[model samples]
Target: MEIMLTPAAKAGLDEWESNGNKKVIQRIHDLVESVQRTPFKGIGKPEPLK
Candidate 1:
């Protein structure tokens, strides 16, 4: 599956690889973790009829 990411976000990921920026990696990982931990209860898209 292909995914699209913001330019800044992509750069953070790349920096983690090339420069091994541990802080940046940790910050990004924390952000993703918080998102996953939070419950998304707002309006969501329903499966389209096929």
Candidate 2:
């Protein structure tokens, strides 16, 4: 599967990497891949706001 990020998100990720926090970037990528593999199927629709 191909993962494409928005321009803004790409910038944010680039900034994050530049900050010397590759772990967070790696975590984000890992989570994205995991979700793509097994996405969350909600039980039902959201309730109406009060």
Candidate 3:
């Protein structure tokens, strides 16, 4: 599965990085990788929308 960030999310990430939240940014990247590896299992609970 591919991960696509919304414009708002991209902007928020940019803002965070500019504010020196590298550790948080790294964690987010790690979470995204985890989700990509296992969409329905890992880190956080995966819930179906409908």
Q: Rate the local accuracy (lDDT) of all candidates.
A: 0.62, 0.71, 0.87
Candidate 1 ranges beyond 4 A from true positions: 1-12, 39-50
Per-residue C-alpha lDDT of model 3 across residues 1-50, encoded as one tens digit per residue: 99999999999888988888778989888888999999888677778679
Clashing pairs in 2: none
Model 2 TM-score, all chains together: 0.60
TM-scores, one per candidate: 0.45, 0.60, 0.77
Task: Name the top lDDT candidate.
Answer: 3
lDDT for each residue of candidate 2 in 1-50, tens digit (9 for 90 to 100)? 56789999899888988898878888877777775765553222324458
Error of 1 at 29 (Å): 0.3
What are the per-residue Cα lDDT tens digits for candidate 1 across 1-50? 23458999788688786887778777767656554555342123324458
Q: What is residue 43's positional error in candidate 2, in angstroms? A: 17
**On a 0 to 1 TM-score scale, where does candidate 1 land against the true structure?**
0.45
